[model samples]
Target: MKEMQTFLKKYHEEMNWEISNESYEKTRASLLNNYMLLTTEVAEVAEELRKAFNFTHSHILNGMKDSEAFDLAKENAKEDLGKEFADCLAYMIKFANYFEIDLEESFYKKMDEVKNRKNRDVSLSRK
Candidate 1:
């Protein structure tokens, strides 16, 4: 993963943006944009808060099979579970993108290929 300074330098070079002329309008616009970004991030955090421990919506959907809740919702059942996870995931993606983290590559290289391939199936283990 690239550090913030390195990523910003690369971004500036790629986009042809001059770091010298960061004027008031540019700063204001960036402030506004960052406010919007933070709002979205906070909403995602709230979603993570909702189904989290000490919350009402907990146990409404199993975390492992989250997509099934959407299927369940199609049959006149509704839970806000999907939105929560979606929002959290969206924020995570955008957070990585904002910092030019290349999270997909990082995940594959650092996590997805090692250490946790599978959880012990307790039911099968008993047999």
Candidate 2:
């Protein structure tokens, strides 16, 4: 995660896409614009899931078993889904880099905190 963040930081700099630090207003606008873009990428990820679900439904309508149909749909969607995920990660990394955040460390810390939380939600079902 650290390596990925560093690479993206360099890549953004090379592309002149780094968040602006020219002035307060410019930085705010840049951050807002990036946030909007990140949300759009998240929506695209949802679209990919929708497409996969539709494909699975279509296959089921044609008499395929639900599990088999879903497997095929998942395989078909895998590449595009991965791309969408990568897009989301890039934006997230950009923000993390801008703030000099250690994402890998933060992720582990957050997971530990969640694990030790006293008010954690109880599971309603087990698979």
Clashes of each: 0, 0
Colliding residue pairs in candidate 2: none
Give the RMSD in angstroms, all C-alphas superposed, for model 2. Answer: 0.9
Which of the numbered candidates is closest to the native, going by highest lDDT?
2
lDDT of 1 by residue, 1-127 (tens): 3454355456645865422337878856754655576578677656554434323223344463444544444333223546555544544554565455777578888775565557733454543
RMSD of each: 10.1, 0.9
Ten-residue stretch with the least lDDT total in model 2: 91-100
* Candidate 2 lDDT score relative to the true structure: 0.95
Off by over 4 Å in 1: 1-79, 112-127
Per residue, candidate 2 scores C-alpha lDDT tens digits across 1-127 of 9889989999999999999999999999999999999999999999999999999999999999999999999999999999999999999999998888999999999999999999999998999
Per-candidate Cα lDDT values, in order, are 0.52, 0.95
Best by TM-score: 2
Among all windows of 10 consecutive residues in model 1, the one with the lowest summed lDDT is: 50-59
